[model samples]
Target: MWGPHLLLGVLVVYTFGRVRCQFQYPTETAGKQYQVPQPPTYKPPTNPAITGIPNINTVLVKPPPFLKLLVAVLYGYKINRRIKPTPPIKKCPEGWFRRDQRCYFFSDKKTSWYGAESLCRLKGGYLAIPDTEEENNFLKETSTSEEVRLQGAPIPHFSRWIGLRSLDGSTIQKIITNELLTFTDFVPGHLASRGLTSEPCVHMDYTSSFLWKVEKCHRGFLYICERHLHFEFKYIV
Candidate 1:
């Protein structure tokens, strides 16, 4: 009887030990809850060579509205200065003959000395005053050609009023320019003083090779007008 009991007790002790070992070390199963320790997360090391370099982000930023407008204005002004510069005016207008940097206009109609001056003023000019022999010759040739073209015949005894006049009926000078008469083409023994009392105004006798002759201021005669050449730029848009 003691041997059977002892055998039974030994069997019981071995079976309990086996069960406790199985409980401590359980087997992996399909429906068991378990927490696995994750391995250390892998991280790539930073490069020390490029660590100090500036970061270049390609973000596009817009300029302020006023700054953009100012830049546009400056660019436009530069282009305009290069392309549309102001030009100087240096030529005579139409119907006015240019000669030695001056302009001349001979009239076909006759008028008194005062009327001639007033007409020249209306035409943006003054009574023609010949300052040199070349200018006198130019006036002579131009007048002769114009007269011949108008009448179809040579004028044998015609005179034209000039800018020379004796202020206070004494000293002769160019009335329009207030310049002394440095040059004169007077006939011999027929100087301006000879007619100072009767005629205060001077005239050019085209028949006598454009010689100077004093005449009455009230007398009507053809006249010449003079002006300076001027030019200006005009945009043609």
Candidate 2:
């Protein structure tokens, strides 16, 4: 009995010592507080200043070549449209006979050939030069009319001095214009039959149907003068 009791007391003592040692030993996280994980902070990026940029309000750009030419043409056309146009020519003056851009005047008084030419020059004209048969007919008709108007009034002679004259007693030429007398109405055989002793100037015979005849330049007769009609243009303001 004493041995069994002694063994039982020794086993109880060993078990109590093991339990107290376990309570006193430190744990892996002993005396430390638990913490939540923290999030990362964010930062914005910065831009650097540039030195060579131009301002939009101050910038100037040239137009294209075609656009510039088009603008210039339009401006020129506008200016041209504002300019005035020229007017047409006017009619001849009063008392002047207008015939194919020319004017004719018949004298009302008798004068020598040289005197007649001087009168024509004073009036800014020359002795008439009949270039065509029609012109010659006109002169003849005018002379006939003048004689008929006279009603056989007595005069020194019934003839008119024409522009034709023999410069060297051979070739007949117009003294006023110096043009050759290409047209003539000399009576048949009258020029060749005239005696060579007398110097001759041309005349229109009013007494015998205005036939052309050679006469002395010193003889007094009525004359005709001719000149070009002047033209002028009128304009609007």
Candidate 3:
């Protein structure tokens, strides 16, 4: 007994309800499709602080404290190998004695002052000149030593010629260098009382306790030669 308009409206409402129940609105996680989670591929470590899941090709390594120190030592040794060592210096020449950085050669034979000068020059040196008390005493001791006696000269030889001479008999001079005598070991009254005619050359007189005395230039006596020492270098393995 309902009106026709009301019946029509009821039918429309029923149709809308059935459509909504049959197909609902799509949700946030719908049945579109689900992908399986794949394993991560291996990669070289870029940062040591970051640790990743372990894989077949991945390995984490850290150097020990001693290993770093050993590497540093090896690097220093390699740098040192590039540098060369200094060569060693050589010593005195053959038949020459070294003293206070000077080389000396003692003669075995006796010769006049001029002859002695020539012989010393032939040996690449000049007649020995004593400049200090130490040097003077050294010459005195060596003159009477067994080293000189072994040269067939009698022990305690009376005198030995030196490089001193005075042409004017007033000013003493070194014969070869022509320099004025700065040091003298002359005996008292030796130079002041000596006559000019008989004495011009000087000699070391053992009788005067190895003091200097004026004598004739023609007298023969043993001599000494001196030269500066030259140091050399030799490479060693």
Candidate 4:
């Protein structure tokens, strides 16, 4: 519905945007930087003080020049109210993890179940272990977004390959409901130990929320590499 008020607001916005382009651009000029003198903490006797007064005792006390200079520089730099920080695309950048409110880059690409676990050790992330509901949600959301980006691709979606495997029953354990999470829409039974088609590695499938399938770990697929980066994430789920 095109209301009169809405039409007026649109006109104002268009005028504002058009008017901004009229501002003049600056020519390149190298500005000269000036240095300031620092005050001395301890002063030696100045050359020949007159009339019983020592210049050392009369010395002025001032802060270090750099400190004052730094303050002045900061004051000169305007904080633009119109300027805003760019929102990051994802918590754990492209091909990364938002685990436990922290961003990690899992460097391990593709390997067998044992090899994947070893790689996590080499890079300091023990597979993609989500310990809390918040963490599980964050990972789920992050993977879902990644899946959206990877839409129409052959592989559904994958974040990281865990050490747990369907072929190797002794090593694999059922991921707890509250803690166990998937990037793809994972339900309870679709992928509970079932990727045993040919290759025996189990990785979560992002497209199927209820499925975690097994694949050949040796073959290289895009992996969510993890490095324990300390960047924090604010979970919004």
Candidate 5:
């Protein structure tokens, strides 16, 4: 009963079914990637009411108890003078007498013996005489760093004179001012141009450690004259 026409019809139906299935839309749509923006984040306000907290008071900070005690202790010491500052000690000059806390130099260069006495009288000091053992000892010690007596006047010898003199002009002797004199028995002598053989002058050299030495008065050298420390210093000119 089924001939060629029925066979052709079945083939056409099968072909049509295949073609329709090929043209049908798929269940899943084609996907496209996209980027989206998020909402802004919030920030809290600075006011105390919003935060529900009390404000700090910066004015009234308390010092530590130990700190206060330490400060008080230091203040007490400063006010009370618990540790008093020591005053400086005054030192007198070596090989010199301290008069009113000052050192006086009688002579430095050659001066005549009598001239030296007169000079001392004028200046306000006497021919330095070591009155005490201490003075004599000080003189001896200050006279040299080495053997003073051993080194005999630097050998080549710078001749000078001392205040020691004789009224009779015979022997070199020590003399004193007659009274408790404010000024010397005499004055500091200088090497002036005196032709007289009796012109023995007094001289002093600090470095040589030679005290007033007696020499010819005519010698040319620098001389020093001492006066009381309390004496008002001035220039005659």
Candidate 6:
């Protein structure tokens, strides 16, 4: 009977202790202890003029059309003044025709092969030497069509002495380079058909349609002189 009474007392004391612990802490109401933030009380001014502050565009004014045009014109004029026009492209001398980087002087008078070469040397150049097909074509096209006579002998065909000749009659070469010809535009059978003679020189035969032909060096013919042309700068005011 004592054990049962003691057990009942222990149980009653534990229950009272739990009740006191619960009452010591305060309780919080739902959604009241931490409130949600409300919207701002004052809104930004809708009319910037009424607020005494100008809009971004108004504060940063754009230049007028005429002012912009004037500024552009002035800038262009300044640039033009600073930058002078590039010097004019160089030109060949008087009575000389320019082609690529070379200047050519076609002779109006006929002379022998040696005479023509000497004259060309005196004039600061050499006999016309065509190293390319384009140059050869130019030479052919530029050659005068005027009749060429030998000692008042009325020759039906005209020709010009070029820079090609074979000293040994076996090895053709350019006098300027003193080397064997690397390029040849000879007529198909002209070389094979021609008989070799002493001191035979080459000429552009108009009768054979600008093909090359071997002839005696003493014979007179029109010739072309060639020289390198350089750029000449000319100033403009």
Give the TM-score of each candidate: 0.55, 0.54, 0.54, 0.36, 0.29, 0.53
Candidate 6 lDDT over residue span 1-237, tens digit each:
799999999999999999988763334644456556699799776775676564679545865544544554455345434433232235666888789878888877777776777666555566787888989988887764334324354544468888888877787888856788777888788777785456468888877777788877767688888777554322221
Query: Whole-model Cα lDDT per candidate?
Result: 0.71, 0.66, 0.67, 0.47, 0.42, 0.70
Name the candidate, 3 or 5, with the larger TM-score value.
3
Task: Show pairs that collide, candidate 1.
Answer: 89-231, 90-231
Instruction: Point out where model 5 deviates above 4 Å.
Output: 1-96, 99-103, 132-134, 140-161, 175-214, 220-237
Predictions ranked by lDDT, top down? Answer: 1, 6, 3, 2, 4, 5
Candidates ranked, most accurate by TM-score first? 1, 2, 3, 6, 4, 5
lDDT of 3 by residue, 154-218 (tens): 63464777777776767778754678878889999877788655577788887777788887665
Model 2 is weakest, by summed lDDT over 10 consecutive residues, at: 228-237
| Residue-wise C-alpha lDDT for candidate 1, range 1-237, written one tens digit per residue | 699999999999999999988774346643677667699998856877656554445222555444544554455345433433224437766778889778888887786676676566556666789889999999988887887776854434457888888876667898645677899888777863486866778888776777888876766678888876553322221
lDDT of 6: 0.70
In candidate 4, what are the lDDT values of residues 8-69, reduced to their tens digit?
Answer: 99999999988997754444432534445588789756677546773554344554444544
Which lDDT value does model 1 have at 51?
Answer: 67
Clashing pairs in 3: none
Residue 121's lDDT in candidate 6: 56
Better of 1 and 3 by TM-score: 1
Model 3 error, position 64 (Å): 98
Winning model by lDDT = 1
| Candidate 3: clashing residue pairs, number | 0
